[model samples]
Target chain A: MLAEGRIWKFGDDIDTDLIIPARFLNVSEASALARNCFADLRPDFAASVRSGDILVAGNNFGCGSSREHAPLAIKAAGIAVIIARSFARIFYRNAFNIGLPLIESAEASEGLAEGEKSRVDLSAGTILRISDGARFTAKPVPDFMAGIIRAGGLVPYTIERIKAGS
Target chain B: MPMTITEKILAAHSEKEVLSPGDLVQVKVDMALANDITAPIAIKVFGEIGRESVFHRDKVALVADHFVPNKDIASAEQVRIARDFARRHKITHYYEGGDVGIEHVLLPEKGLVLPGQVVIGADSHTCTYGGLGAFSTGVGSTDLGVIMATGEIWLKAPPTIRVNYEGRLNPFVGGKDLILHLIGMIGVEGALYSALEFGGAVIEAMPMYQRLTMANMAIEAGGKNGIVEPDEITKAFVKERGPEAEAGAVYYRSDPDAVYERVITVNVSDFGPQVAFPHSPANIRDISESGTVLLDQVFIGSCTNGSLEDLRDAASVLKGHRAARDIRLIVIPGSPRIYMEAIREGIIETFMEAGAVIGPPCCGPCLGGHMGILASGERALATTNRNFIGRMGHPESEVYLGNPFVAAASAVLGRIGAPGEL
Candidate 1:
């Protein structure tokens, strides 16, 4: 349950429309969405993003439009984790429902620098900066929700439940 | 525990005796909705779940809005997918063409949603049904897919934040200005994960359409839903179109001693029309301070302010005048029903006579989906909710959020002006 990655920092209120614009909504495939992640705000994001990179953003991340494409694109683009000061409620649930782990830590999102390597311990709900060895605590995901994430999102979780019942 | 209105409704839907904030409960959904933008993906997920059929076909609604008239081939294919799924599933409320409009407005207008029911939609403005006393919230496409299969979904009982707006309303200011000012008073995330309970004498006397306008943008301030207590007005409004809703209405109000996470109050008698500037709905100022902001386009429609009353108000302002020579004014009715009513009442004729373009009943430019996408450096004053950057068009374009009166006046003056200026 540990995720390690280089940080990609963003500012406050980075809305879902910016993460994946509505124009690309026609294509629902995860790869197509990943190809255009952050196409507007950062044109080079989809190209330059490396696997296992983390997104660190200021408050109210994923604020506008309830498009789950935003989180789907991030996870599809190989972002290992998202650490934001706070998130819009719908985005928070959608991210978790899709198995993209997110952490909320005001101190970490504010202090983290772009390109800094960080380690996120999902079980412990702690984030550690690799360079300076700085530590920040994130709110722990509820046990039931943690189980859902461990099962690789709600779909797989439901599939397992249905299979068990049968 | 003393329960707020939202808790009571959720408890009823979940068949629980009592509920509290942070409690997770699976509630039976009375209605589920999706638009062209989200329905395609939801249908995909529904197929992926390997379900033979939906749980309840009549309870699910699919509306082709967002990119109506099919802006491009991709968008056309998206709507075609939703249409095919709805046809295959025989969903009772499949809507397209003239029947299609913003789902939030059309649901209530068609009586598909009722008070005391639990509703969920794929679009954020699903909270608009709270105006009629339903406990509704938005979810993602996957959640909609799950609801289609299971007929229920788990939700957290949100804490209530009481926002009491007292005092008389100003002459020209209406629900749009009130909501804009409130969002400005409280930052974008002020009510994160909380239900906003709107009350006071002003809300009590406000028309149901105005209440819908106010509750529609509750999500703009990060509220799970915004609701008003069901009263005689609500009963009457629902009774006219939906006798079942009126007969089955569960009238629940907050206990006087109910606990609230926070309570914010504002007196609107002295408040004038307010506008949210470019980039954010929270960046607001009074119309008087707008300082001659020029406009390239003026739009009056959306789930927020596209009702018959909104059209009437705009027509009243533009009765004897024409839009500015360089300005393009567009007026879209909320639904085909509203469109027909406006035509009968001559509201549409008035707008067209004033040189305004009348479009179909669709959410054209609101989400920057199509119809009126702004060009670079262009500015638009619209009555729709959300002024987020690139919301109406290009990232460089600016959108100012205001009411129909301000939109009409600005159209006439070619600036971000108010009704008083007219």
Candidate 2:
């Protein structure tokens, strides 16, 4: 899948509490959570984010909390994809399990600037800056994870498996 | 093939004889847990999975700890959904009301998680069970929902990072300091996607409660799990729980020749009380080096360090002196059992006499869920894990992390000071 969007850059260790605080976790509805996305760290994130915007962050993006609400809120807030230098273990799993694609590219994380339009080719693992025509390569998503994303996340993937009696 | 303890546990559960890091395998889960916050979402996904009931009633645990005693209408509704789901499935390990405690603390205290088991929970700190030699890790709610249906989870075997702590520990320095020092040294992502095998002389002498505290914050360092190999201390602790606790237990240790992705060694004798300053657990400094930062609140609880021993540590410092007039000191025991033990030992009386508020055995303000949230520009020093932005309350509010002694002494001094000051 290819995603073209404006970039929203964030720094290292963009923790779950920063993405969606525990105060907002009482409600699990995607839309309700989306309204509070980055409510504390980036107060304007929820209201100003446009559809298909790509988030570019430094290392350990989505550290702290195993709350899937973090990724769900970001996805519902109209973030199409994320590119980070690296990701916390659970956050990486949560994002893919919810079908939100993430790319790991130190070069792209350093090169991408906020509000700059960019194009990301998820399957190809390439991130291109439209303004400078700079291209960066990302570590490919593992095959098994890609399959889950292809099935639109783990729920549908597991549904298919159970139906097939696996 | 020589395998680390983590590899051995995963291989034992999976249909494989040997495994390596990054090898994806489906392993049977001996225990699956979800709390009020994560369980509602998992229950919703379980419905989408079209499961009639959970794969196994007794193997699944549902606890209402976070935002419980029902923080508000929304939190009450969330817990109700988890309650209904638990009742519908007749989940035997379901806990709520007075019976509920932090899931990580309550589960092991009840002997639900045992050695060499593959445990999964919807909460990140589920790795806490690794202190018992279990191969436990956290998963998202949807992943947990599927695990509830199938009683299995797919995971890539994580590489192992062995941390060796040697030398005699200084007085008042314990597991919280050790773990905080490690996080500070490694940064948050230093051990990303790897199991941290904590070993060496210091760990061997460490008590179970302290070991659990170290394991509980593994996620803070981006670790898949933090584990201490089951030894005589582990066996004795499990044996105290009951014969049932040891029924299916397996004690596995890393082979002498086990391969590790990396090895980190520390000498504890040279260390002092450590603290993680605001907004990040990795922003650490030794107590002497930490500047005089005043506090608005002092919290001593959570799955991380809310055991009976932790309360005793705090009470020892607060036995005679009261909290500083302007400071708020809140203490929540990890579980009802721990709370009752504290009362029997006069620890509760000591806290109350010191003008402290003793909250019920729940998560409390550790997650900013309820009971003593901070206002803007306020600061708190807590014994709980995680000090992320706005973790204890408003975004502008800051949090510092330390052991129970530092928390108590800080309360008395009304600033970030050490027990030595008293």
lDDT of each: 0.89, 0.94
Residue by residue across A1-166, what tens digits does model 1's lDDT show? 9888899999999988789977778777889999999888999999988889999999999987889899999999999989999999889888888999988888888888999999999889999999989999988888878988998887777677667863
- The residue-level lDDT of candidate 1 at B35 comes to 90
Quality of candidate 1 docking, DockQ: 0.68
Error of 1 at B216 (Å): 0.6
Candidate 2 chain B, run of 10 with poorest lDDT: B240-249
Question: TM-score: which candidate is best?
Answer: 2
Q: What value does the interface RMSD of model 2 take?
A: 0.7
TM-score of chain A of each: 0.95, 0.98
Best by lDDT: 2
lDDT of 1 at A86: 92
Query: Candidate 2: which stretches are off by over 4 Å?
Result: none
